[model samples]
Target: MRPGLFASPRPDNLGLHDGLLAPAPSTPNGVSSQATDSKHFVAPLPMPTDCCVSAMEKLHGIIESLGHAEIISADDGYLHAEFHTPLLGFVDDVEIVCNEQEGVCHVRSVSRMGHSDLGKNRQRVEDIRKRLEGWGYCC
Candidate 1:
């Protein structure tokens, strides 16, 4: 087994800062809907007109439904989850920042290590986006 297979350092650049999730790093190993640049830009999730709690529950449900996902922290409008790569156990941190007033949810996903992740972070967010849409949410 690879050393540190079960260990992942806590991400230093996570959480809601001023009602927004942190931007994705310049590296390809990260992606964020809030990112201004095209390289890291993803469309934010669109929330239904329901209450914030209901929207959060839907978001939480989608994340939890992902087989490899483990929610680390959550609250009324924020959530952090870790997704593990099946083979090597690489960890990716995903955070969602819900802006109830705007009816959108910002997202960020980043690998804990490596200079590049072959677009996995971007793909992961896209996958979640699709799943949310399938469940009657929009983006």
Candidate 2:
């Protein structure tokens, strides 16, 4: 079978919209730091300093070290990555946007398929938050 064969269609709202990473899908398979609802809201990672560029670079390294993450695109303030599950080969798209003035990294993570992810999306964000915090960044 092809990779992501069971994956849902690429979301219309996938990338940054109006200078913000797209909101999490209404389904429980997604979560976003910028979301307004408790179900979709995850806290943005707080930067250790005023340098968002350097912070993003650090985040890049962290994601790479997480194993299944493949960074599809990245710039000083924005990044996109794909994370694959080990057994079933599910794919999740993760995006991060750095706000320099606010010194935070806004993030969104969504499964490409499924209405429920068994809390995987939320766990991943929490994991990322913990890892970033260990690096002296806050979330």
Candidate 3:
């Protein structure tokens, strides 16, 4: 498949609102730490002993190590990245917000265009979590 052949335009409802990332959509193609429904909910990543900025930096490194990931925007405690599948090149948006007070990093991952992702979003997040754990950070 051609790259981005199935990619949809970036959604307007991304980023943190009122100190929380946007909720996951009511579809199986998305997953979010802030989601209320079990089907779309994933636990936030536990912050390390270092500062939130450090955690974000570490997270940035992890994302960078993953091929086909493009950093869209990164702020002090927030990051947005797009991941392309190896075969079809389908795009998936990933957003992360560091909550210093809560000692966690909230994350959201959603397919750009699809009714179901066959659990790709969740698996991606889990893969990230595992990588973070390798750096001595726990979820």
Model 1: runs farther than 4 Å from truth? 1-6
Q: What lDDT does each candidate get?
A: 0.81, 0.82, 0.87
The digit string of per-residue lDDT tens for model 3 on 92-133 reads: 999999887788899999988879999999998999999988
Judging by TM-score, tell me the better candidate of 1 and 3: 3
TM-score of each: 0.88, 0.88, 0.91
Candidate 2, which ten residues in sequence have the lowest lDDT sum? 1-10
Worst 10 residues of 1 by lDDT: 1-10
- Predicted structure 3: clash tally: 0
**Native-structure RMSD, model 1:** 2.9
Per-prediction tally of clashes: 0, 0, 0
Model 2 residue 9 distance off true place after TM-score fit, in angstroms: 5.4
What's the residue-level lDDT of 49 in candidate 3? 43
Assess candidate 3 and give its lDDT. Answer: 0.87
> For candidate 1, lDDT tens digit of each residue in 21-113?
877877778988888999888888878545566666788898889877888888977889988877778888999877767778888998888
